[model samples]
Target chain A: MAEFSLIETIRERCAVARDDVRLGIGDDGAVLAVPIGHELVVSTDTLVAGVHFPLQTAPFDIGWKALAVNLSDLAAMGANPAWATLALTLPSADAPWVEKFADGFAALAREHQLALVGGDTTRGPLSITITVFGFVPAGAAVTRAGAKAGDWICVTGTLGDAAAGLACVLACEDGADELIGRLNRPAPRIAAGLLLREVASAAIDISDGLLADLGHICARSGVGAEVCVDDLPMSEAFGEYADAPTRQRLQLAGGDDYELCFSVQPDRAPALLWDLAQSGCAATRIGQIVVGREIMLTDDSGAQIEMPLRGWEHFA
Target chain B: MAEFSLIETIRERCAVARDDVRLGIGDDGAVLAVPIGHELVVSTDTLVAGVHFPLQTAPFDIGWKALAVNLSDLAAMGANPAWATLALTLPSADAPWVEKFADGFAALAREHQLALVGGDTTRGPLSITITVFGFVPAGAAVTRAGAKAGDWICVTGTLGDAAAGLACVLACEDGADELIGRLNRPAPRIAAGLLLREVASAAIDISDGLLADLGHICARSGVGAEVCVDDLPMSEAFGEYADAPTRQRLQLAGGDDYELCFSVQPDRAPALLWDLAQSGCAATRIGQIVVGREIMLTDDSGAQIEMPLRGWEHFA
Candidate 1:
């Protein structure tokens, strides 16, 4: 098949009815209306085969994760998903693979009502680059530089599940479908993010582990953090599969959770959590922002705990 | 260096002061205020190392061409450039190469006052994906679906130069600096596009040869076209380096020209040409849109001319 034919297939499968999109897939550039009083939030992410995921990962999962990761960035910014463009480089025009990939992408896009506006497909090694655009009310975006020293640090959803999931996949373990699912199709916390924007002072998505990502908050907000190790949330599957040390390590340092780690003032924490729960999202308070510019982990008795692993860096 | 530090390096280098940019770099996403009464125009393009360009192409040229091509899409839409996000996949973190690449990208960005908002760096074979966002007045953006059968076909600048440049490079021919530069750094027709927005019936940027790009307009506008082969523009360098057959082949089916091919009504063509010339962009009337859905090329005497080469199609 030619590139245009593949693009036509993707367009047919990923089409969504959106009023704000003036022009969608078949244009040199997509024209979109930014509703009055809204600011645009943009983020780009690239996932390469073997480097970002296992070479054997299903095409559907690859498509899901590619869009999911970019959506996660929008979620971290407290923006509502609107549209996205995909730049896919493939070894060849594998029709079956493209079909499955489009199916995976379309499924997630439908859930959020996000339209695929425009994209480019080229011949090369297998890789997917997705750039997501979202919107927030003007001057209403929650960035990573607004945390105060006395703010309470909170996170949406469980931590370390994706890490545990990766471990399971690597070890060829059995009966770990839940963990594997977490790894393959981690959900973006868009709802939680929208709610958090009303109360959270600082926010970031955990793609490079809790410590590393929170460290970004620290550096950006000029504040430190103290995480209570016992307060870290873990899934039932993770609890059963990981030993104490492994759990601690993965919970603290594991990447690809796609959970929002944010800071809220102590006064607003209860109300925010209640609102999140009402919105069908469970959130947990795990730490507090402190004066020092370092990330510290503490146990129940408040003793500092050593980090087990460093965060994943693309090039180190 | 780690990814974040490298990002910091890029942020420091590509940073441009813009009032509309609420937050850029160091965040989960970039936030920008879209101007009121305007709509957003978005486009994406990806360039792989060997597939899109010769492997030995300079990083500077790679970066320049990547952004240039995306900007071309915005140009085709008659949108003014504003912001762009880059997703760069590199085999290794060669700081010098990155520095040069950023320099090239920054040079063009500075010319148009386009901001580098956010980007991703990953480990993979060399590839660059750029998503550019521009703005046009509501309902004023030119699209490919608006051409009428009586419109006159026009193209900005010259053709065949880039293809001839590629041929020179592939043959290791010396002293073809002009041709090679055309291949490495094709200028996007931003100014022409902005002007054509008022006069052109439909528009597209010529990247995949004029015939193919014009074919897109035909497919979208539901009209056909006839190109006068003798009227096709050729640069001095292209004329010097190519024989009659080579020139005809390259000019008729060359890729990477990054020029605007648009359609305008006959009554508006003269004024539009004068306006374009005043704006320092030379445009040529190459043909006319016709009633049918086929692209035909003819000599000056109106005799049908056969095309020498096919347009480049990915994954064909």
Candidate 2:
């Protein structure tokens, strides 16, 4: 098939409602309207084969993960996703493959209420880059630098399901089907993020492991944190893996969780958890920011535990 | 180098004014603000080596062309280029090559008053994907479906220079440096697009050849067009190449022109051209809309020109 035909097929398959999209995939670009009083939050992420994902992963999962990760970014900022543009490069225009990928992509996009605004389809090694946009009220979005020294650090949902999921997949472990699914389709905490917008002093989604991501908040806010190991939230599925120490390590440093880790004033922390539970998000008080530059883990007796501070590095 | 270090380098090198950039690089994603009263125009283009450009093209030209092409999309919408996010895939991080590419990209972006808002770098065969955003007045964007029959077709600047340049490079013609530069760094006609927005009934950037791109406008608008061969604009540089017949063939049906093709009411066409010329854009009326479904070209003696309607098609 020709390139134009491929684009035409994609346009038809990815259609949600072309009305909100002033221009879709057929034009030079797309035009979109930003409703009054809402600011646009723009974010771009590129997932390359063999780097961002394993080569043998299903195409649908690849497509779902590509858009989901970007949506996570918008969610971290407490913005409502509105539009997305995809720049796709593939070894060839495999029609069946593209159809499945687009179906997977459009399903997630439609579920999130995002319009497929515009995109480029090209020839190259498989890579998918999505630039996502969301709307947030001016000055209401959260950032990493707003954490205060006295703020309580909280996290939504399980901390290390995705990390444990990867381990299960790598080991090909039996009875680990649910764990592997978490790695493939980690859910972004959109509702919790929206609910925490008014209360979060600082926020970031856990993609680079909880410890490393929290370190970002620490470096930006010029404060240290003491995380209570006993307060860590781990999925029951993770317990089927190695031992307690291994699970703790995964919770602290294993990445790709897609859960929202945030800081809130001490007064708002308790109510926020109840609010999060109502929204189907489990909340846990992981730590507290303090006046220092070190990130430490304390046990039940407030004794610091010695462990390797390893995090996922893209090109380590 | 690690991906985090690579991103830190980009964050420093691609820095522009930070007033409208709520967040730059190095986060899960960047946050940016689109100013009030302006609708956002978004576009993404991917340039793969051996596909978008000649294999031996200069790094600087490649960088310039990648961003310039996306800007042309914004220009076609009568939008002002504002923010851009680049996703670069390279075999490896070649230090000198990366520096030169960044310099070229920064220069073009700075000249257009566009900020390098955010980006990602990854390892792969050399390719660059840029997602660009522009701002236009709400509900004032120029789209392809707005043209009406009986409207005059006008194109800003000359077409065919880039095509001729590509030919020169392919034929290894000596002393065709200027032609080669036209292919390498074609101006996007952004200012002209903004000027034509109010007057143009419909418009599209001439990328997939005039016939093919205009066909897109016609198909979307449910109209047809009649182009006059005698009125087609060719640069003096293009005239120096193949005979008039061949020149008309290649120029009219060649891709990568990047000129703006637009429709205007015949009554408003003359004034639009005059206004465009005053603003330093050399526009020429090349055709008119018709009441049928086919694109036809007539020569000076009112004889129909029989020509193949060939244009660029990927994956053909």
Candidate 3:
């Protein structure tokens, strides 16, 4: 098993036909034709064996999650994913593991119509770095600095499921496969992100917990947010927990939910809601932008609620 | 040191103002405004501590070489270096090590006027993955599939220096500091690559030895090459290695030179050589493309030389 042959295996496995990819793998670099009048969007993410996922996680899950996280970034920008390059490091050249990894990666790639442009494979401790490229209409990208005071804040899909899934995987909780699935393959809200481009003032994907990710929009847009605790969407899997505290912790502060968190102008909230509903994206109105420079969480009675937990912080 | 602060340190340290960079080093991803009528070229490479370099190599050299290898890919395609995103993995976040790594990376980046884009850092075994984005004129990129039978073959800078440097480093050969430098910090023949776009029938960078990389061009272009061993470029660092076998081994089969290998029509050779000379890139006419279906190497008196060494291969 030579390095060149391994790359050929990956190329054969991940092959997808896309006109935009003028050149794919097997070149010094990938040549891409960015369509006229379009702006390119790119992002990279690295996932470690034990730090980002459990060391025992399957190769398929690892490959899927690596691409998923990077796609989440493109989704945040309201960009259509076009291509990806993977820089994979492995402890050894295990044929079955590599084949399964490519299968998982290719399955999701086909689903999103993402072409594998190029990549590198090396011998090292197991880790995967995926750099995804996408395109959006010029000046149409929804960045983090556009939310204004009085904008309505919303989130797509449920929060806390992936966090609870992580807990389940780590504790070996019985019959919590649903939660574990969420952890292994949290879907990026790509459609929802594109829909929001027409109405939302700011957008970001929830990688860190809801509070932390929303706070990013606030900090960047120079506006504060007021989120209602009861409005936080927790999946049914979280109901299995005995106490509300665990659910709240996962919902507010646990990370790895690839859902879209966005803000819309007050005047456009109706249109945003209608469009999302029409597109079958389960979006929930959770909060509003305020003039103050702090993100405040409150109960239904208008009383301020204390922060339930600390956000996930790398290298803290 | 939280991840955010660490990113800020990298952002500040690696900051180089470039007009093409609309935004850099923060947010969900970096934004760039590609010039009109240009295509985007991208490449990714990962360097592991033990697999790609000596485990005890200095942090500065590691950072410089990591970006250097990726730049070589862009050079092969005649693409100008524009922006880069790094996905760095480390076992721990040591501040001193991080700073030195940033310093080394930034120095090379600034030299090429490449901006630091978005990146992700994780705790894991030490490895660095860099994805570089460059731009070339629409439909004007030098590709590996364009060489014809009459094209003259050439290579830039001296070959064998990097490989000789590797040997010295491994054997602790004295007074070979220059060779070690050549191994650790290869200058990508970027200017030469750009100049060859108008004249070269095909171009590639010498990373995995001359024969392997040229084999790429020949394989893609459906051509063969014939080389004169006496005409191969060898650096003065290998003067002590008087044996023809070792010289040929280091000159023809050693990897990591980061020099541009190109093929131009015999009629255009004069112009190509003049252009390279004006750009301060030392290029030599090593051989010519032939009609036969093999890359043949012969001595000055016409006897064929056996391929004495195999190129570096991962997972071999």
Considering only chain B, report the TM-score of each candidate against the true chain B.
0.98, 0.96, 0.97
- Native interface contacts retained, candidate 1: 0.98
Best by lDDT: 1
Ranking by TM-score: 1, 3, 2
User: DockQ-based ranking, best first?
Assistant: 1, 3, 2
Predicted candidate 2 versus true structure: per-residue lDDT over A213-239, tens digit per residue: 999989888889999988898777876
Candidate 3 local Cα displacement, residue B3, angstroms:
1.4
Q: Is candidate 1 or candidate 2 better by DockQ?
A: 1
Q: Which candidate is the best by DockQ?
A: 1
Tens digit of per-residue lDDT, candidate 1, span A1-316: 8899999999999998899999898989999999999999999999999988888789999989999999999999999999999999999999999999999999899999999999999999999999999999998899999999999999988999999989888898889999989999989999998997868999999998999899989999999999999999888988898788889899888899999999999999999999988888799999999999988889989899887567888888
With a 3 Å backbone cut-off (N, CA, C), the pairs that clash in candidate 3 are none
Q: What local distance difference test score does each model get? A: 0.91, 0.83, 0.87
Candidate 2 segments exceeding 4 Å error:
A18-20, B170-173
Q: Write the per-residue lDDT of candidate 3 for residues A1-316, one digit (tens) a residue.
A: 7788789888899989999888888789999998878777889999988888999888888888999999999999898899999999988999889998998899889899999999899998889999998888887888898999889999988888889888888898888888888889878778887887767899999988888898889889999999998888777777775478778778888889899999998788888888888888888989899997888888888899887566777788
What is the DockQ (computed on Cα atoms) for candidate 1?
Answer: 0.92
lDDT (10s digit) by residue, model 1, range B1-316? 6777777777777777889999988799999998999999999999999889999999889878989999999999999999999999989888988888888888788888999999999999999999999999999999999889989999999999999999999999999999999899988889999998878999999999998899999999999999998999988888898678878888878889999999999999999999998998899999999999999999989999877456899998
TM-score of chain A of each: 0.98, 0.96, 0.98
DockQ scores of the candidates: 0.92, 0.66, 0.80
Which scores better on lDDT, 2 or 3?
Answer: 3
- Give the distance in Å from residue A294's predicted Cα in candidate 3 to where it truly belongs: 2.4
